[model samples]
Target: MRIFALETDINKIKQKFCHSGESILLSTPYHTFSFFFSSIRELFITIALFVVGIIAFIYDLPMGWTLGVLLFIWVVFVFFNLLKAYVDWLYDFIIVTDHQVILVDQTSIYKHEIRPIHVDNIGAITTSTQFWNIFPFGILKIHLKEGLGGDTVMLKYVPHAEEVAATITRAVSSHQSRSQTSAQRRELSGIDDSE
Candidate 1:
């Protein structure tokens, strides 16, 4: 999506919002912070069942009881999917802006928050993953300077993470250069007033 304009002093930004180019990108770190457990929920359940199954086998439970345990596990798997969906809907974030990066987040249906990441303060764009995620669904982490305060907003599970990171990196660099030049000009003019 193309950046159209950004007004940092007013805390406003605008970006292209065509459905085709629109993307929901979350910081891998943020995504993992919120729903990282969802990825391993099934694994933990499976392991617990394996341990229980071994104990049940030792006790020689009736075939009916064994079937019941297996059914319970199946139900748990279905419930896990529901939980994952809810997490996805709850904390999803989209970075939308034509000139600067604005983090648009929905904390809840009734509450929403948007934070702008100064393009100049965006330090680096990168991605990282945990040991387990590498094999199946790899995670992407974008690192940035804490200019506007707080941690970097990660883009998690992004399919084309490298490409997105590159775009952000370039944009941030350009923003910084422009900011440096502006600062120099303002200092030379000795104008500290904001209007």
Candidate 2:
């Protein structure tokens, strides 16, 4: 039963985004560390509010009930903020296909941006690490041609960034080879037509 549901979901995704002869080569969300980093501010705020609520309750302050109400609201706000952060982290993914690379940036439940770059437009791919490689996460940067969705697309906190970059590089080269073969065929056909 579970496998059936998973298959259905996969089919739905393929139908929605994939074209004929196009297959997904790689699809990965940002590393787990990114989720904590993205929601760090909210976590700190929640901790501070919780401490204040505890102190107010312990002192039996005159306005303790009001403070409790305010803290309750603050808790809700923090919960939603963390939810948004998780949603952003989980949904924002980099997908490499045979024909193109797709970046899905989901900032919130209601907002997302999809950037698709054809493999031919990708000029260069590089990876960078933070804090002298202390962390396992790294960044993947793809340099694109002019007028192709700005200059570069950077994916932060990517686990195994080097592997992902290599996969994209391979995809780009594969696309170039296929394009050359097709162009040669077209040129040969043109000669035959002229003859």
Candidate 3:
């Protein structure tokens, strides 16, 4: 899939480091119900319009006029969808290097908020899949650490959220393990110096 936008600092940091010794993985593109449902609805609308155009031609209505109307509607639909896709793509809740979680939310070109949470500091991870959001599909509400402003991140509508949660948990645990090992190494080095 095409990457529309990546965190600038994240990119810069990765380039500066020669090697992390472990691969940094990011999650797949996720969208809200509104996005997926609208796209699906547009497909149906396009099909219905095609059928109507054929019917108009058969009934001796001006074929050119019918086609023009359909074209106009399609163009409008596409324009709106393009905007929606861009916004949805920008609004991502991301985990980076298993050390940080960043939520990039864009309200407009000039208005936005970027929240960063340290994975080591995270207190808890909670997930909720609501029935209404399932609509034609379900979404996972991933809440991380209470009391931290905007600590919760939604994966929006996705398939197999349990598997995704498992993946995230593993990443977080791995980071935790590395941190612990580093602390222990530091302590051992200090003891050797004391001797």
Candidate 4:
């Protein structure tokens, strides 16, 4: 699967990072049902338009138009709705790296918000699934530390949330450990000591 025309290869994405030694542990987009169901209103509208077009074709209106063209436009409308949903889902993503948990939210074609929670700054993680959600689809909330405004990264309609959370948790732990060890080494070298 591709995401907004971008290749979904985790390694390729990791390599794209400007900072060296960054490794992507997990990368995920919203679940398939999430994308499809989100455009329900558009789907209904497209269906209604298609029915209208068919009616128009059947009635042989005063305008000279063939059934083929009507059907083509109907298909195009339907495709547009689907493509919109896909583009929205594709552009937004949740990614866990060795250093942080990143939430890439694309609100519009030109608007994007990239929030990265450093491993040491993550306060908590919460997840919930709707009663009707049969698959591993749910919402994920990554709470930041108190000093950092205590903001939460809210991700909706995520798939395999349990695994994703675990991946983030593990990455956080590993990052914290690495930071701690590096700090300890600095202390040992008297770099943190007041001379």
Q: How many pairs of residues in model 1 come into backbone collision?
A: 12
Model 2 lDDT tens row, 18-41: 688899999888898888887888
Per-prediction TM-score to the true structure, in the order listed: 0.44, 0.85, 0.57, 0.74
**Residue runs of model 4 more than 4 Å from their true location after superposition:** 1-13, 16-18, 57-60, 63-82, 107-109, 188-195
In model 3, the number of clashes is 1
| Regions of model 2 farther than 4 Å from truth | 1-11, 62-67
Candidate 3, residues 99-160: lDDT per residue as tens digits? 65555554334445556556665655555565754443345555656566645565555545
Candidate lDDT scores, in order, read 0.53, 0.79, 0.59, 0.74
User: Cα deviation in Å at residue 107, candidate 3?
Assistant: 12
> Which candidate achieves the best TM-score against the true structure?
2
Clashing pairs in 3: 134-137
Which stretches of model 1 miss by more than 4 angstroms?
A: 1-91, 96-98, 105-113, 129-138, 146-150, 180-195
**Best candidate according to lDDT:** 2
Model 2: lDDT to the true structure: 0.79
Report the Cα lDDT for residue 138, model 1.
37
TM-score of 3: 0.57
Ranked by TM-score, top first: 2, 4, 3, 1
Candidate 1: tens digits of C-alpha lDDT, residues 102-143: 555543334445666655566666665545555333344545
Query: What would the TM-score be for candidate 2 when compared with the true structure?
Result: 0.85
